[model samples]
Target: MDTYAVHAEGLRKRYGGKDALAGFDLAVRRGTVQGLLGPNGAGKTTAVRILATLLRLDGGRATVAGLDVAKEPRAVRRRIGLAGQYAAVDQVLTGRQNLEMFGRLFHLDGRRARQRAAELLARFDLVDAADQGVEGYSGGMRRRLDLAASMILAPDVLFLDEPTTGLDPRGRGEVWDSVRALVADGTTVLLTTQYLDEADKLASQITVIDRGRAIADDTPDGLKSAVGGDRIEVVVGEAADIPRAWQVVAGVCREAPETDHGERRVHGLVHDRVAALTEAARRLRDEGVAVEDIGLRRPSLDDVFLRLTGHRTAEEKAGAAV
Candidate 1:
C-alpha cells in the first residue's frame, strides 16, 4: 500500500498572464484528512480539479494513488472521488436512483449496483428519503447523497470542496461526522473550506494558500504556536487607557491591539502566563487604571493566519477587487 495517497511537486497552471496554481507542492498521507484553506480565488478549486483529473496541469507533476494524473487520468479518476461545492445530483432522480445511476456508470452489474445503492442510502441515513426525488431533499441531505454518490466505487481518496457551505450549524456537524466516518474506514480526504473552525476541527495537517502560492503549512497546534504562545487579552475601562496600558505591556511584550464597541484591548504573547497576568494587573493597579476584564487563552488558527498572511480571511476577500 502506498504511504501517500496524493503527491504533487511544483505543479503549475496558468490562465492568461495569471498563474492559478504556481508551483504548488503537497503530500497527503494515506488515511489522513488534509485541509486546504485559503481565501476565494486562491486556486484551491483549480488544484482539486487538476488532481481529480478534471483539468490538465500546465507543468510539474502530480499523482493520485501513484498513478500519474497526466498519463493515467482514467486510473487516477478510478481511485479518487470529487464532491464539489454544489451537490451535482439530478434533482428529478430519487436518492436511490441517483446512486444506482453512478454505480452502473462505474460498470457495476445490476445486482451489485442495487446493493451499492442500498448500502449508501443506509450509510448516509437517507434510506427514509431514498425513494423521494432529490428536488425535495434538504441541502444537508443532498450534500450527504452527493458524498455517498462519490463513494459508490469505494475510491481510495475523496476530494471535498467546501463540503458544508451554506449549511446550518447542525448540518455542518452532520457533514463533519460523515467525513470522520470516511477517515475511520481508511479513506484519504482532501477538504477545502472557507470556515477556519471546520479546518481546525478536522484536519491533521493544514496548508494555507494565498493568491497562487502556499503561505503556510503545519498541524493546527503547530501553526498556532508560530504566531506565539498563550495570549493575554486586557480590556480596559476607557479608550484613553489604551496608551498607558500599551506602554506598560509593550515594555515586556509585543502584540497587536484590537478595539470593538466601547472596549479597548491589547493581546500579548506570554512565556509565563501566570507571571505575565500578575505583572499586568499590578502595573494597572499602580497606575490607578480600572481593568474591565482580563483573559489568557490559546492562540487560534485565525491568529496564525493574521501572523503569516498579514491579513485575515475576511480582509483578503475584501481586498480581492484590488
Candidate 2:
C-alpha cells in the first residue's frame, strides 16, 4: 500500500510573468492532516487548484491517490474532494437537497443520490436541520454542508483551502471537529490556511511557504523547538517598575530581557522554564516590583513564523498587496 495520498515534486505555476508556485513540493501521508501554511498569495490556492486538476502545472510532477495528476486527471478527480475558501452550496435549497443535488451532479442516480445525501446529512451532524433552507443556517453549518457536499463520493483525499477563514471561534471549532472526524475515518487531508493556530491544532506535519516556495517543513513541536526554547514574560503594573522587572527577569534568565515600555512588559528566553519562572517570581516579590502578570511560555507559531520568514503572516499579506 502507498504511504502517501498526495505527493508533489518541483511543482510550478506561472501567472502573467509572476510565478504563483515556484518549485513547490509536498508529501501528505495517508490518514493524516498535512498543513500547507503560508501567508496570503503564497501559492497555497494555486497548489490546490493544480492538484485538483482545476489548473495545470507549468512544471514538475504530482500524484494524488497513487494516480499521476497530469496523465490521469479523471482518475485523480475521482479520489479527491476540494472545498475552497467559500461555501459552494445554494442558499435557496434545503441542506439535504443541496447534498442530493451534488450527488446527482457527480452522476449518481436518483436512489443513490438520496441515499448518499441522507448518509452525509447524518455524518455531518446536519440531520436536525437537514430539511431547512440553507439561508437560515449558521456560517459553520453552511461550511459543514459544503464539506458534506465534497464528500458525496467519499473521496480518499480532501483538500481544504483555508476552510475556517472568516469563521467565528465557535464556527471554526465546529469545522475543526468535522475535519477531525473525517481523518478518524481514514481520509487524508491537505489543509491550506494562514491561521497559525489552526495549523498547529490540526496538522501532524506543516510546510511553511513564502513567496510561492516552501521554506520549512516539520511537526508543530519541531518547528517551535527549532526557533528557540521557553520564555519568561512579565507585565508590570506600573510603568516605573519596568526597569526593575526587566532586571529581575534578566537576572533569572541570565540574558538581557526585551522590554516594551509602552506595554510595561519585559520578557526573555530561558532554558529552564520552571526554574526561571520560580526565580523571577521570587525576585520580583523581593524587589517590591508591582507585577501585573508573569508566566513562562514556549515559542508560539507566530514567533516561529517571524523567525523563519523574517515577518509575520499579516506582514507578508500586506506586502503582497503592494
Candidate 3:
C-alpha cells in the first residue's frame, strides 16, 4: 500500500546488558528485494523479528504493509510472510501434506486447503514431489516447500532469513529461482544472508549493518563505490619484484597499492580499467618485472562488506551464520 513494504526507525533490542539492535533503521521498497547484510550479532535478524511482530522491541518503531507492527500485529501478520534460516516443514508429511497443514492452520477450509496445496505445488515446481514424503526430498526441495508454507496466505511482504545457507550451488540456485518468481508476482522481500554473491544477484538495494547499527545503505553499485573505484591488481613472478610491482601500480593508479607479501601481490584503485590494465602490463614488461598475473576488476560486494564490517563475515559464521 505504501512505498515501503517494511520500515523501521531507531529500533532497539536488548538481551540482558548486551544490545541486539541499537538505534537501527531500514526501509524495504515495495515489490523489490532488499538485502539486509551483516555479520553475526549485527541486528539483522533482530530488526526482522521486530518488523515481523515475532519479537517485542525495547524501543523504536516499525511497520509492515502500512500497519504498525507494535500497534496492529494481527493486521501486520495478515500482510507478511516469514521463512527463517532453516526449512520449517514436517519431515514425515508429504510435500503436499505440509502445504495443506499450513493452509489449515491459516484457517482455510478443507477444500480450499487442498486446492491451495496444489497451487503451491505447481507454483514451486514441486508437482512431481507433491505426494512424496518430505523426508526423501533434497535440501532444495524441502526449502522450497518451507517457502511455499510461508506463502499459504500469499502475504504482501516476505522475510527470508538466509534461505540457502547450507545448500550446495545447485540447491541454492533453486531457492534463488523461487524467490525471483515471487518478486516477479510483485511480492516485496527482505533477505538476509552472509553470501555476498546472493545479495549481489538478488537484492535491488542493500543495507549494511554492523554492531547492531545501520552502517551503510544503498544500491549494490552505490555500496561498492563506497569502497573505491575499479581495482588494478598484479602478482609478480618473483617475490623480489613485489616492491617494483607496487611502485608501477601505485604510479599508474595514483594510489599506494596494498601488498600481500606471502602471495607477492599488489592491488589498488584505478581511474580507468582498460587503460590501467594495458599500461600496467606494458610497464612491467619494460621494467623487466615478470608478473604472474595482472588484471583490472570492479569492486565486489565482498570488498564493500570488508571495508564496512572490518572482517570477512567471519563473525556471522558462529553468531548469525547467515
Candidate 4:
C-alpha cells in the first residue's frame, strides 16, 4: 500500500504572465489531516485544483491515491473528493435530495443513492435536518450537507479548500467535528485554510505555503517550537507604563520584548516560562509599574507565520488584494 495518499514534487503552474505555483512540493501521509496554509494569492487554491485534477500542472508531477494526476486523471478522480470554499449544495433542494442528486450524478442507482444519503445524514449528524430544504439550513448545516455530498462515493481522500471560510465560530466548530469524524474513519485529508486556529485544532501536520512554494512543514507543536518556546506577555495598566514593562520583560526574558504602545502590551520569548513570569511580576511591582495582566503563552501559529513570512495572514493584512 502507498504510505502517502497525496504526493507532489516540483509542481508548477503559471497564470497570465506570472507563476502561480513555482516548484511546490507536498507529501501527505495516509489517514492524516495535512493542512495547507497560506494567504490569498499564495497559490493554495491552485495547488488543490491541481491535486484534485481540476486543473493541469504547467510542469512537474503530482499523484493522488498513488495514480499520476496527469496520466491517470480518471482513476485519481475515483479515489478523491473535493470541497471548495463555498457550500455547493442547491438551496432549493432538501438536504436528502441534494445528496441523492449527487449520488445519481456519480451513477449510483436510486436505491443505492438513497442508502448512501441516509448513511451520510446519520454520519454527519444531519439526520434531524435532512428533510429540510437547504435554504432553511444554517451556515453550518449547509456546509455539512456539502461535505456529505462529497462523500457519496466513499472516497479514500478528501481535499477541503478553506471549508470553514465565512463561518461563525459555532458553524466552524460544526465543520471541525465533521472533519475529525472523517479522519477517524480512515480518510486522508488535505485541508487548505487561512484560519490558523482551525489548522492548529484539526491538522496533524501543517505546510506553510508562500509565493507559490512551501516554506515550512511540520506538526503544529514542532512548528511552534521551531520559532520559540513559551513567552511572557504583560499588559500594563497604563500606556505610560509600557516602556517600563517592556524593560522588565526584557530583563526577565533576556531578550528585547516587542511592544504595542497603543495596546499597552509587552511580550518576549522565554526559555524558562514560570521563572520569567515570576521575575517580571516581581520587578514590575518593585518598580511601581501597575500591570493589568501578566502570563505565559505558547507561541501561536500566527507567531510562526509572522516569523517565517514576516507578515500577518492575508485576512489580517490591511489593504490586502483578493
lDDT of 4 by residue, 6-99 (tens): 9999999999979999999999999999999987788999999999999999999998999999999999999999999999999999999999
* Pairs clashing within candidate 3: 40-316, 194-322
After superposing all C-alphas onto the true structure, candidate 1 shows an RMSD in angstroms of 3.2
Model 3: per-residue Cα lDDT at residue 164: 94
Q: lDDT per model, in order?
A: 0.87, 0.92, 0.91, 0.92
TM-score of each: 0.89, 0.95, 0.95, 0.94
TM-score for candidate 2:
0.95
lDDT of 3 at 100: 93
TM for candidate 4 is 0.94
What local lDDT does model 3 show for residue 189?
94
Give per-residue CA lDDT, model 2, range 150-267, as digits (tens): 9999999999999987899999999999999999999999999888889999999999888888899899999999988888999999999988897888887756789888889999
Model 2 — which ten-residue stretch has the worst lDDT? 310-319
Per-residue C-alpha lDDT of model 3 across residues 241-305, encoded as one tens digit per residue: 98889888988886777999999999988887888899989999999998888988898988899
